[model samples]
Each structure stands twice: as structure tokens, then as C-alpha cells.
Target: MRGDSLFGDLVRAHRRRLGMTQEELADRAGVSVRSIGKWEAGQVAAPRIGTLRALADAFTLTGDARDEFLTSSALDDITPAQLPLDPPVFTGRERELAQLSASGDGTIIRVVSGTAGVGKTTLAVRWAHRVRHRFPDGQLYVNLRGFGPTGPPLPPGDALRGLLDGLGVPPQRVPADVEARAALYRSALAGRRLLILLDNAADAEQVRPLLPGAPGCVVVVTSRDRLAGLAVTDGAQLLLLDVLGTDAARSLLARRIGADRVRAEPRAADEIATACAGLPLALAIVAARAAAHPAFTLAAVAAELRTSRLDVLAGPDPAADARAVFSWSYRKLRPAAARLFRLLGLHPGVASIDALASIAALPPDRVRALLAELVQANLVDEPQPGRFACHDLLRAYARDLSDRLDSPSSRREAVVRLLDHYLHTALAADRLLKPHRGLGPRRPATHAPGVTPTPLADSDDAMTWFGAEHPILPAVADLAEESGLHTYVWWLAWAVLTYHERRWDRRDWIRWQMRAVAAAERARDPHFQAVSHYNVGYALCELGDLAPAHGHLNTALAFYEKLGNLAGMAKVHLNLGIIARRRTDYTRAIDEAETALALYRKDSDPVGEARATNNIGWCYLTMGDYTRALDHCRRAVAVHEAAGNHMGAGHSWDSVGTAHLRLGNPTEAAACYRRSLAAFRSERDRQYEAIALAHLGDAEEAAGRPRAAHEAWHRSLAIFTEIDHPDAGEVRAKLASREVPPFSLRQQIDRRP
Candidate 1:
């Protein structure tokens, strides 16, 4: 960073360290928030160095820090004013905006390039417009008209004339010679804080002359080419723009078409975005079409685009036509690359090189070369090494083309190979996640000649694989079910449920669980249907959707009883016991837990017995039967330890802590709570950690340390808020009541008796 801005940087850093917002820091410094923003933006103003000294004093800098602070802020740097109007449909470049903004520490030269109509110019213009106040000196804009099809791209010499003109140099004084103009332009921008946006450049050579040879000036260049030369020579940060995400795309459509109209057809909005591949250019054209025909339903547009994507995305302007924009890049690809791009449409999820290799019937090395060519052309993106996917629109375009270019049998064969790859890989990962399962292992599919399963070496690999593949699971399931692969459908959902269920991701759990239940019903397997109900019921119960949970659980119980499945019956009873405990029906809870425990013992399953014992001990703790709760909880802990269930043991330790607290043994209770907290933390179980923290606070208060108790409650409250835990309200209430006395109704001690 330039020394002139160091003080501003330091002040901003320290303010952030103190977790103060700009307004709060401004208040402390006895200045307007606008002043603080200007200072941080490296803007020079009239207030002189005293305003900066006030800022340093507010931040409480001392010694060398104070000396550095005063030195950095004392240098008054001119701000530039060089941005233009913003595009109407600007949305979702938050990450790129931050990157571009922070690149100001040194020479701020950023090159934004993507396929045509990817909103490269829109992003650059919007960002520059927003940061206008930072550049008080001046803002200069010059469009080179590269790829505009409006004559040829503007020459470098002519571009310099436009820039020099914006800098207010007299037209006759501007040199006719390109090299002389470049030197003059450099001299003009020297020591002046300026923002230079060289838009739609044909190439690096076109943009190279316009760059200011000054530290204070920022240059943003947009182009269709990657402009590798600029990055290699001038050290420009290259930001490759991709299609907007689904939510952002929906929001973009809503902006052009009325929000009320979009909301009325919310599904159509999402469908349109999907069909548009979240490309801003395509969405804008579709929105414009919708606007032109106010009576046309968005669903009709979505349906039309689904079959004729490239056709519907067309407009009067070549740039507004999504297909035309994509074709510009697509036409640049080699035959092999173009063929591979077309083949990707047949694959359901993102394709790994090996999967693509099998689908294309090519060698891995050969496939990599083809994919690299497509990547360079920006027609395809390799999000990770050896894994390739295209934006939604690109994929649709490819699919539509492939349906004609490739034989139907060939596409069907490619899909099967892709399906086989996922199904086998999922089963392998599921085995590592849960080696022992209620259901038997999924039998390996008879692979096609070239298809291979994804190999997961261990549990960690399996988990990483699961995380990477989870987003693709829903799509994979749909493909599997549509292909009449019912076993694969149910198995895929069941496997993912096992991996994620314990993590308590209620949304994904509920979604996939429903899919699994449907798949199981289609399979006409009684055991599978009952087990699917059990899985979903458990998830719903955890989510506090008790009404549905009760019906699912009861359905599972009846099936298990009819099927004479002792283990399933015992598990259902244990879950029922938990529901009873939630309602504080301790007597019924104990009865249900006892029945589960007896069945578990009869079945010789220590894990099931341990789970039941823990539930019963939890009930005793709730009833304030401290002595019995502690006894049962200790036994539960030992059994859980024997069964090697750390999470189960953690819950028991927590119950033991609560029992000790109620029995007036605060120190012991605190120690047990600490142990439980540590166990949950190691497991990364925030839900249980919050509960442990709340109980720990109770023990802290019992030990006469109200301050420590307050901290514990606050810590618990934050986690509860993060997880949207049901106990959040209670914790918030406790924190609020910490400084107040509350009315209490309690039974008087009858000492006379």
C-alpha cells in the first residue's frame, strides 16, 4: 500500500478489531460517518490532519503506532471521479466487488472477461459507479468497441484521444502520434488520484497505452478475451465472470418484469432462470419479451425455452441473443472440444474427467485436453481439477444440439454410464459413513464396458465426497427414478440421509427423506418402506414437526410389529419415549423407554439399550429426581462408552451434570458439564453444545459466580440463534432477566411437619 493511505488502513483495521461499525467509529472520533468513509477511501479534504489525529485518538493508538498513524493520514491524496451510470439489472457480484475494491493496496488494475453477454461491462460499470466518491480527482471512461460489430474495434491511438479528451486536454494539443499521446496521457494522470475504466478492449495492446503510470489511479478493463498478457506483464487481477446463481437470477428477472408478476409465478420465475442458465443476457431478453406481451405467462416462456432455448433467447441485438453470445465462444472451440462440450449434456450431474472419459469412450488424457480447450474458450468451466460442468444455458444448448448430432442410443448409453458411476460411488461412500446398517448393502451394478465407480479410500474421503456430491444427489435421484432404477433412487436417498441426518440438516433431511419414502413405496419392499418411515420420522421429530412425525412413527411401528422386526420395534419405542419426554410425561416416557430397553436386551443390542437408558435418565433429570437420575445417567454413560458412541455418552454426561446441579453439588455439576461440552465440541455438534452451555451456566450460578454464569448464557444464546434452536427464546429471556429480580411462586418449607 502507498504510505499516504497507511494511516487510513490502520485506523480502519483497529476499528474493525474493536468490532465497531463505521458509524460507531465516527461517533467515537467525533466525526460524521461520511468523513470516516472518505478517509478510509484515501480521499483528501479540507479538515486537515487534526481530523485524522482525532481518529487516531479515538482508536487509542500509542507510541510508534500513533507516529505511523499521523504520518500516513497527513498526506492529502486527491480522490478521482471517473465512473459512469449503472446498468439496471446489476445483481450478485458481491464476491467480485470485494476483490476489486481490496485490490487498491497497490496498482488497481483488474481485467474482467467472460463469454459474450455474461455482464462483464455491467459489473465493471456498477462497481465503478458505486465507488465514485473515492475518486474525487476524476473518472474517465472509454469504450474500445471490441467485438461490438460496430465497424472494427477502436484503434489504440484513437482510444488515447478519447481518454485525453475526458481528461480535458485540448483536441489540437493531443498528439497525432500514438507513442507521444501515451506519454502525455501518463504525465496527465501522474500524481492524480483517478479511476480509468477501459471498457470492451479488443486485446491487451489496445488497453496497455491507457494505463496510468501512477499508484493512485485504478484501471478496470473489460474484454471477451482472457487478456493473459495484461496479467503476465502488468500484474492485473483477472476476474472471470460466470452466470449468476439461481437466487440472484430470480432476483434479476424480478427486477425487469414486475416483482408482483414474478411472485405470482414464483416457480415459473425459477424455471425460467434454470432454462436461461442464470445468464443475465438471456434473462433480460426473456424479461423484455414478457414485458412486451404482458398477458403471456412466465411458465409458457419457461416451457418454450426448455425445448427451444437458443431460439427464445434471441433478440434484435446480436449481444442480447444468448445463443449468439454462446456461439461466438463455442465456434472458437476445436472439433474435439465442441464434441466433448455437447456430450456433457447427457450427464446428470457435473462430470469428472474419468466419468466424461467413459461417456465419450475416450482416454482420460485425451478427455483432459479437449476439456482444457473448452475451458479456455469459456464455453465450459472446470470448477475443480478434472471436474467439468457448464452453466445451465450452455448445458441446455449443448443438450439440444447433441440430441440431433449424437444418436439417441448413444445419449442413452452415456446417461447410463453416468448413472452407474454415481450409484456405485454413492454406495461405496455410504459404506464408509456407516459400515453397519439396518439395510443390506446395495449390490454393485453391472457396469458398462467403460464405466467405473468413484473410489473413496476412507471415512474422511467418503465425507468429502459426500459434501461434494450432496448438491448433485437430487438431480441424480430424479434421473435414476425416471430411468426405472428404483433401487438406486431409494439407495441414494438412504445413503445421503445416513451421512447428513445426525448433523441435523432439517431441510435436506426432510427433502431426501420424502424422496426415499416414495422410492421405497415404489419398490414394494415392506422392510424398506418401514425403515424409510423410521428415518424420516426421526428427522421430522428433531425438526419439531411433531404432527407428521407422530404419523410416520406410528406407521413404522405398525409395519415393524406386523413384520416381526424386533430391532425396528425397539427403535420406534425409544423414539416414542423421546417424544413423551419432550412433553414432560415422565411416567409414560419411562414406560416406553423400559419397553425399548427390554426389547434391545432381548435382541442383544447394547447400542439400542444404551440409547434407551439415556432417554429414561433424561426423563428423570427433567422430573428433578436427582438421585435416580444420576444413578441411571452413570449407567447410561458406561453403556454408551462400551458401545463406542461418543455423542450418546456426551448426552448422558450432560444429564448427569444437571442431576448434580439440582442435588446442590455445583462443582461436580460444572466439571461434568465441561466434559460434555468438550465432547460435543469435538464432534462439532452445535445443537448439543448449546444445551451443554446452558446447563453449565445453571451450574455456574449455583456455584455463586453470577458473572461467569452470564457469559455462559450469552455464549449459549449465540449458538442457539445460529442454529435456530427452539431453546433460543428461553436463553434470550434468561440473558435479559440477568440484571432484574423476577417474581417467584414456590412452596413454603413446612418445618413444623
Candidate 2:
């Protein structure tokens, strides 16, 4: 029979001999009747010492009856040899333990948190054992299973029963109401210096009831998550555990298998230690296996562990087996927590709290609380502050669980929800960055399976979401492609491109554009493919990679031409002209610009015609054909103004000013420059405004107003510097010349003549 069962049988025999009913016996012992049944039936062998004591007192037993009960409850048979109390002494944990121990006499709640097998539980147990003597009344230990391979977590009521029984309360006496029972338990230990060890606690809610009221008692909890709520609400001291050091693992091995055996097979032992990945439980199991078998070499054990550590560790003793330990914890979680754990494993990369909230479609605060529960169970690790990650092994297990528990449709829906969240967020950011651009036709809202779309309050909220989620956008794009979310892939690419261009993230621009192009092709949509190619070409041109830009643009033009899309073809031509102008090939620039203008006019696309006209003006200005440039730029401005394209009007005004400045018409140039600056300022385009300011300064200088010119130049230079423009170098040069001593009026005239 199991040790628990044997002990239960012994309790039953004593209770029967005393002629006391289970309830009456439980009432005197201060425990639940169910506990009495389990104990008597030998189903639960290890009734706590206090519970056994309560049973003894209830029976009013004396002499041999009490001795037999005490002996039967003793864990001597279950305790293997030395009991592995030190459990492969952890290295580099002195500082952590010291911090935990020194957290003070007030309800000292320290959480040793880490990924599964990262030694959170071992560290917590080690620390508890070390500090056990500090609490003179005795120490209490309970495992509030948070995560495992089994079913849901044991209810709080069940945990309270165990705790009350451990504290010498008989089965029937323990209250069914968890809160009342906990309150009574706390009141019982009010003035005592008890050390409570709540191991693998599921959350603050689970641990809250078990907390003793005595200021002298210390509570040390261990988990795999941050448990921020516990610290925030309960003032619990948070100590996040990490992996054991190589040296510590080596020492642990040396101590377990003997210094000579380890030294002789140092490499093998090191490998075994490394395979454990600094998980003390894993290390202890391997060491114990080796210790039990003297003939088995460390090298042999190491090889076996490397081949299948999980299988090897899934032994009968849950405490010594990583998988068993995890399973035990898993068996004790709520159904919601178990489902959440599995779903989270389906995430392709590290998910932010908000993303998780959106995926679960739970209230943000509630989702956060659930995540905290997972952390406490030692199933998740908070590697960085506010970010949780599972071990790679645990992640694999979670994924397996997800596959088994969730249907393909459900999994697909979850993925779609995550993708849509990113896509919508990116779209909002795009609108915020380029408010003037006509937003594309909205796709019909298709609710993800099991998920509803969250409404964004405003552009500001959207922008904030985008900013926070920007780091993970690339991963989302990759996931979209992998998941065959073609439309989402391209649209997300387009949305993020707006922010990337605004921020001048050239690398990301290229990356997303390539992804978008592939997605567009998969979608087999000509319009989207054309747009993707055009944007890719644009980004390439920005990076000075004209060959690739030409290739992409030429391909895009052919597609448009085949479709008889004159407007689209015209836009491509206009872009080609801009590229040619950048390359200083003015003739080619003019040709492309003229072709675009003719096509736009034929198509009667006003926006296309205005853009083509602007390109023509820029080409002529670069070619020193100032008169033609001025005429084209003025016409472009009129077209754009009529179309209500304020940004386009700003560009045309700047071009017209440049043409006038080159033609030595300062009065006309100043008027155009001021108009350009006003438009740019109104649009909040600081970079363009700075360029206009510089041109205005030049026009003032040419008009023979030296003091006015100086002021304008200074203002322009300041704007350039504020915007961190590359052209600030030239602005500074002009400013330096202005600061030089001026020639007299007669000398100035002579020099000019």
C-alpha cells in the first residue's frame, strides 16, 4: 500500500477504536470529514504532523495508540536516505536568498520565479529549508499546483483542507467556506513565528488565504511568472530566479557523485549538468540516478539524459522529475488557465500583454491577472520586466497541448485575430502619419472565429498602439506570410511602410515591401501588386539602388500597360521621372515626365495630371530651363489647389520658387517661397518648411536687403538644424558668409559691375 494509504488506515483504526464518529472526531481535530475518510481509507498517507497531533488529541489517546499514530505519520519510509534536502546546492543564489530572507519580519513573501526546470521550486525549497529554524513554531509547506500535464488545478477549498489538516485540524472541523477557514487558520497562528512555504502557488488569490496573520511568519513562494498583482496588491517581495551557473552545477555534481568520480569524468558530468540546463530538480534526479547505481558511470548517465531527459525525468517522484513536477503543477490549474497556456504557446513570437488580451478577447485587466496566474504556476517565465516567455521545451509541450485541445479552425481563428489586430493597428498609424492620403476601400469586417474586433477610439489611440507594437510588426508580417494571410500581409506591409518612411527606416521599408510584393503576387491582385512594386521601387530609389528600382518600376509599368491602366501607368512614369532627376539625368527625367503628363491628360485623372506636371517642373528646373519650370510649377499648383491637395500644392510652390531663384527674379521667388513655407507649415511638414526658409533667405539676399537676408538665413539655418537635415551643412556655410564684415556700398557696386 502507498505510504499515504497506510497512514490513513492507521488513523481509521485509531478513530474506530476510540468509538468516535468521523464528524465528531474531525470536529475535535479541526479538519474536514473528507480528509478523515481519505486518511482512514489509506488514500492519503501523509497527514501533516499537526493534523496527526489533532487526531491524537481528539481521540484523547494515551501511550501506544499515540506513539503508533505518530510513527505511522512520520515520512521515514518515504524519505529516501538523506532526503536530498540541499538538493544539489545551487550556486550564485546566495545573493537572491539573502535578499529574500532580509525582506523583513512583516509578511515576507518572496517569489522565486523562472521557466520550468530553471530551478524556481528547488531554490524556494532550499531557501525555505535554510530559514526553517527562524520560525520557532515550525514551518508549513504546500504545493498549490499551477501548471502540469494533468487536469485543472486543485480548488482553493481543497488546498485549504490540506493546510488546515497540516496545522493539526481534524477533517470535520475544517470549514467548507475557504475564507472562514483561512481566517481561523491565520488567527490560530497570529502570534507564532511560523514559516509558510507555498510552493508552486497559482496566484495571489490562491496564496492569499494561506497567508498567516502573524507578523513573525515568513512566506516564501516560487513561480515561473512575475506575479505583479501579488506585489502590487499584497506588498509581496518579488524575486525572479534564473538559471544556475556552470560552476554551481559542477559543484552540485561533485558533491552528489563524489569529487573523484566527477573529476575522472569531468567532461561527462559537465555535459549532464549542461543538459539539465541549470534546473536543480533535473540535476538532482540525474545525480540520484547515478548515486543509486554505482556501476553506472557519469558518462553513461549523461548520454542517457541527453538522449531523453524528459522521459528520464518523468519518474515516480514528481519532485525529482521535471515533467512529473510540471505535470503535477499542471493538474492543479483552472480550466481557463490551462486553455490560456495552450493558446499562448500557439503565438509565433513573444506576445505583448495587449496582444495577448486581444487574442483572448478578454478584458485587459482580467487577461493580465490570468497571465499572472500562469507565472505563479512555474509554467511561464518573466525573462524581462513585463514580458513573459516559456522555456523552449515548455513551449513545445504547450504547442502539442494546443494541437490536441484546440481544433484546426479554432487555432486558425486565433491566428487570424492576432494578424487582424496588427493589420488594423498599422492601418490606423498609416492614417495618422499621412492624413491627407485617400484611404483605400475598407474590406468587409470578417470576425475571426471566436474573436470580436476591438474598436479603436481615435487616431491617437491607434498611433499609441502602433508605437508600442512596432517592434513586433516584422514578426507579424512573417506570420501572415507563413499562415497564408495574403491580404493581411500586403495591407500590413503598406500600413507599416507609412511609419517606416516617416521615420526613415530604410531597411524595414525594404523588408516589408519584399514581403508585401510576395503576398500581393499570392493574392493575384493586379492593383495591389502594382502598388507593392511601386512602393518597393520607391524605397529602392531612396537607398540609391536605381538598378533594382528601375527593374521593379519597369515591371509595374508593364502590368499597368497590359491592363490599359493609363492612370497607374502615368503614376509609374512620374515616379521614374523623379528617380531620373535624382540621378541628374535631366533629359531622361523630362522625357518620362512628359510621357506621364500626356497619359494623365488622356486618362482625365486630375490627381495623376497634377503629379505629372509637378515632376515636369522639377525636371525642367534641374535642367536650368527656368522659364518652362516656372510655367509648369504654376500650373501644377493650380491643379493641386483645385483638387484640394495641400501637400502637392506645397511641393509645386517650392519648385516654382526654385525656378524663379535660378532665373534671377528675387521678388517672384520670395513670394513663391513664402507661399511654399506657409503651406508646408500648415501641413506640419517641418523638413519641407526648412527648405522653403533657405530659398526665401536666398531671394532676400538677391534683392539687396542684407539685414533682412541675414535674419531670414539665420531662421532658416535654425530650422534646418532643428530638423537634423543633411542640407544643414550648406545652410551653415551661408550663415558663416553672412557673418563676415560687409563691403561698403561703392565697393559692392564696383565688385558687382
Candidate 3:
């Protein structure tokens, strides 16, 4: 009466009934006493079928006793199913499992390839159990122990020995040579219709000798290596696995904890998936931890796993440990590729090939070749062309190795090189976008040639480049501050400001620029500090935070005065004028604009001078002084045209249109607004284009051209709403208030003609 007791306990219970010691059982079963003791204590499972039968015979057991022995020994039948019990919460891979069962596809072999912990072995076994009936003869599974905490991989001959035993071949009759055994294995499997799964093989060679050379049997091989040789030579169908998608990953966790609990706390489950990076093994571990403590919430589990990831992911079993699984693949890498793998986790996230080269301190071409090796090994992904990123769990593992393998100075230098790469390269791109921008001092002496950015063709290319790099820049600056590369902290932030302004990302501009100011204070660089505050203040003003915006701009003016930076003073003064105008303090706005104009003229900077003059006109138009607004705006336009600043000239023209409308000259107003819209379009400034359209509607309304007014206002409303601009509300109100016009503008004008 073994009941549900552990197999070892049942063996010990039955053995003592017959007065047998560990020594007596070992001698009778032809196994070591150590194996008997280990099994009884649950350190290992029962011995093989042969040993089990011997022990049964040695006991002289009757029917019930013999049946209990075979059942408890995991050898009730001859066909071995060493496939581990799959987790209860198994999910995803629906597509991959389907391909395995498509009988007519003629794919006898399927190589499930991916990085470590991607669930290759789990997939193979799950598919095998599903399709086991097709192979009525039997199913077979082996770990191969190809990449593990164990010593070398199981040899082909050893694997064949195990396969032959499972096929019911006698140990004494099994052939000694690997070739002969493989031949015998195939002969035994022939016409029988069986399934074999080789889990975690090192390469195709380890897999090939084990594949049954028969039509009916489907052989599945799982490995971290791509195993291209098998596909080429053995006609194996390769199934490359990737991490689970977001929804699938969450569903897997839901199935682990009760679906009710998971649905009630979806965020907690999402956090778990994010922390595990969609790896089934890590998710399973977290689920196991939760199941062990039924009262524990998933949030509590996530927080624990987040703090001590590797430690929590490591269970008692070596195969279950994420770190051990990673180490197996890492140890397989060549020296140079391994070094890059460890150092790459030091970077924030995805990066360009040149950026990685900069961190590695190697030439770009050499570094790219090394990276290709990692790509082939499935350790890293080229998610986008020229950009490489490791899986999140792998990144954490790499960080752990980085702390161990790389020296402190080496790690610090690598990060420094990375920061410098973004700083100098972004500055180069920004300058290309705005040719009037200043080029900073000669590139840092520490810069390797790999720090170079992609060569930008024009402003269009610059826009695409900035869009990709925007997320990385602030992170690079933060890394600089954390690593105490104080110089890079402010300088890189200062460099990216030009892109952020035109890109109109007010949040990132303000956040990163403020960090730049703090870093500049640490570096004790007043000029750069002034630049940071100036840029941040402008973004705040745009975002409509008048008070803090005023404070930052005033502080920046003080810094510029101390440095005697005329151009800096002119820029800050011009922005203060803009803020004043936005706040409706037209008098103060004009005064700030006059001071900025004087500074710009003193520095011989015509563009800055024109910008100041334009702001004065804006203030004048707001104050109902049409003649003065016209005079100043006309002067601004003349200077901007001479300087070839089309965008600036366009703004001045828009101001002139407002002035003419205030003077009751609708025809002249409409003419100027048209000029402004064309210029803004040429500059690709959608925000400004929307502004011009809105004002053009106002001018058309003043001219009694109702049809033209409706057209202009509707277009403006669409643009504003699309860009999420605050002015969209006002434009919508205007459109809503308008009545349908009786005639088209063309019809009214045609009647006059």
C-alpha cells in the first residue's frame, strides 16, 4: 500500500519489510548503495528499469508488490518519457506547436533555436505530448545536458546507449560503436512510428547522430545555437523562438496565479512580465513563488523579484536557475565577443553600431564583426538595422558579469566613451540642422574614430536622425552625471537643445535641460549653465509656466552678464520679451526686445538683431499701435531676408499681416498672411503653419469673405488638433460659432469682375 508517498519512501518502506539494508538492496539491484540512499532521501529519483527489475526480483515480491515497484520506479512500461512535467501555467507558442503536427510537410526534424531561457526544450516536449498518438510505437526524450552546470555534453555514443535502452535493446547486446548503435536505433524505430526530442544540444553534430533516420518518427532538437548545418545537410526544419509578446506573457502569468486574482490586479502581473522580460522560466519561477505563498499578492512578488532578480530566479535545481542557463551560453562565446557582451550591458539600451564600438574602444568595422558573432549565437538582436540590444534579463546577467569580469576603470572608461559618442555626434547633427549654430571646441582628445555619427545629408535627414536619438541623449547625459563625467553632463544636454526646440518635445526639453543646469553647477561652468537655463526657460515659456519660466530666464541673464557673453545675453533677452508678450505685459515686452536688439547689434549678429526687432513689432501689434508695428516688422523682414533666414522672415510677415488688419486694410492683411504660410510650409513648421492659417481666417472674416474664412479656420483647427496644440480649442470655438456663408468667395469676386 504505497499510496501517494514519494517513490524513494515507498522503496524504503517495502525494502525494510523484507529486512534489506542499503548494501543489500544495491547488491541485489546491481546499483551503488549511494544511489539507494539518495533515492530514499529524495535527493534523486528511482534507478533505471533494469535496476528496478533486479530489486523486484531480489525481494521475491508477489503481484501487488511487483506492480507497486514498477509504478513507483517510473518504469511501468519500456518506452522512456524523461520529458519533465510541464508547468501548469504553460502558454503561448501556439503557432510553433502547430507547425510540428503538420504531417504532410515532410519535416522529420525541427530545430527550435533561440537564446537561453527562450523555452526551446519546453516547446519540443509540449508538442511531443500533443502528437504522441501519431507515434503509436512510443515517445522518447533526453536532456543531452549540452549546455548546463554539468561537465561536458553527453557523447553521441552515450546518447545512443540511452536511446537503445529505451528502445528495449539489452545493455549487453547494445553496440559499442556510435555508428552501430545509431544504425540499430534507426532499425528498431523503423516502421514503428515513434517521437524523439533532443533537448539543449550544443550543435547539429550532437543532434545528427541521435536523429532517427526514418520517415514516420519526428525528431526535435533544441539549442541556443542556430544549428544552420542541420538545415543545410539534414533537411531539418528550423523553428526560431523569440520572447513572448506582451499579452501572451501576461496571460501566462494569469494562468499561474488564479485568473480572478490576476484580472483584479493586472498592473502587478504586467510588472512581473516586465521584470522577467517575457522569459517563461523566470515567469514560472515567480509563479512558483506565488503559489508557495498563496496569501502573497503579485505586487509583493514583483517587488521582491525586482530587488533580487538573479537570486529569486535561482531555485534549488541547476536547470531552473536563470543565471546558470545564461552562463552556459556565455561560456560558449569567443573571448572578444564575450567581452563586448559584458560591456554592452553597461550602455543604457539600444544603440547604433558606432556607439557600441565607442564603448568597446575598438574600430567600428572590427567591433561590427565581433557583434555579428553574438548575433549568430542568438545572444543579441538586431531589432532595427544598425541597432543592437540584448534581452532585458540577459542585460541584467551581463551587468552581473560586467561587475565581475571588467575592471572598475575599464567599466568607467567604457561609459565615458559612450557618453562622448552621443555628445559629440549629436552636436555634429544639430549643427548640420542649424548651420548658424556654433561648433564647440575641437573634439575631445579621448574620442575614438568610432564616436563619429552617420553623415547627415540635410535638414530632412537631420529630423529622422534626431527622432531616433532623442530618447538616448538624455539617458547618456544622466549616465555622465552618475559616472561623474561632469563635463559631458552639461555639454551633451546643451548640444541636444537645438533639436528639441524644433522637434517641440517640451517635456524632454525641460527635464533634460534642468539636469544640464544641475550638472553645469557641478562642473562650475557658468557659460554652459546659462545655456541650459536659457533653453529650459524657453521650453517652460512655451508650455505656459510663466513664473518658473521667468525665474530661470532671469538667472540665465545673470550668468551671461558675468561671462560677458553678448550673444547669450541677446538670446535670453529675446526669450524674456516672448514671455512678457505671452503674459500681456506689452510695455515690458517691448523694453526687453529693445535691450536684446542693442546687444545683438553690438555683437554684429544680424539674425539675433532681426529676432529682437520682430518681437518688438509683436508687442506693438498686441497694443493696437498699427503704424509702429508695421514699421518694426518691415525692418525685421528686411534684415531676415538679407540674412537668408526664411523662417524668421516668415514670422515677421505674419506680424505685418496682423498690423494691417488692425489698420482696417483687409486686402493687404490677406496678402501678408499668404506669404507667411508659404514660408512656414517651406520650413516644415507645422505648428507655425497652423498659427498662420488661424490668423488668415481672422483676416478673411474682417474682409467680409465668409467662405474663405470658413476654409482657413477649418484647416487651422485640424492641424492644431492633430499636433495636440492648446490653440486647438480656440480654433474649434471659432469654427463652431460661424454660420454658413451664402456664397463662395470666388462667386462674390466673380460678380464684382
Best-fitting candidate, measured by lDDT? 3
How would you order the candidates by lDDT, starting with the best? 3, 1, 2
The global Cα lDDT (0 to 1) of model 3 is 0.81
Scored against the true structure, residue 197 in model 1 reaches a CA lDDT of 90
What TM-score, to 2 decimals, does candidate 1 have?
A: 0.63
**Lowest-scoring 10 consecutive residues by lDDT in candidate 2?**
75-84
Q: TM-score of the candidate numbered 2?
A: 0.65
- The TM-score ranking, best first, is 3, 2, 1
lDDT of 1: 0.79
Which residue pairs in model 3 clash with each other? none
Error of 2 at 393 (Å): 5.0
- For TM-score, candidate 1 versus 2, the one ahead is 2
**Candidate 1: which stretches are off by over 4 Å?**
1-112, 119-225, 233-303, 314-325, 334-336, 346-371, 381-389, 407-439, 442-472, 498-503, 739-753
- Hey, what RMSD does candidate 1 come out at? 17.5
User: What is the per-residue lDDT of model 1 for residues 560-642, given as tens digits with 9 covering 90 to 100?
Assistant: 99999889999988888888888778798899999999999999988778778878878888887779888988998898778
**What digit string (tens of lDDT, one per residue) describes model 3 on residues 1-753?**
111227677778878988999898888878788767766765543444666777788778779878777765543245555556764456888998888776654438888989888888878878877777777668788778878888988998899888877876656545566776676576566565777888888877888889876677878888888888998999888888999987988888778777887887789899989999998888888888888898998888889878988888998887788998889989988999999999998887888888898888888898899988888688988889989988889989998999998899888878877887777777667666566665546334456434545667766776777788887777777678788788787777767776666655667778778888888789888877787788788878877888898899999999999989898898888989888898888888999999999999999989888889889988988888889989999999999889878788889999999999999998899999999998777655667888999999999999998778899999988878776788989989988898965876878788694
Clashes of 3: 0
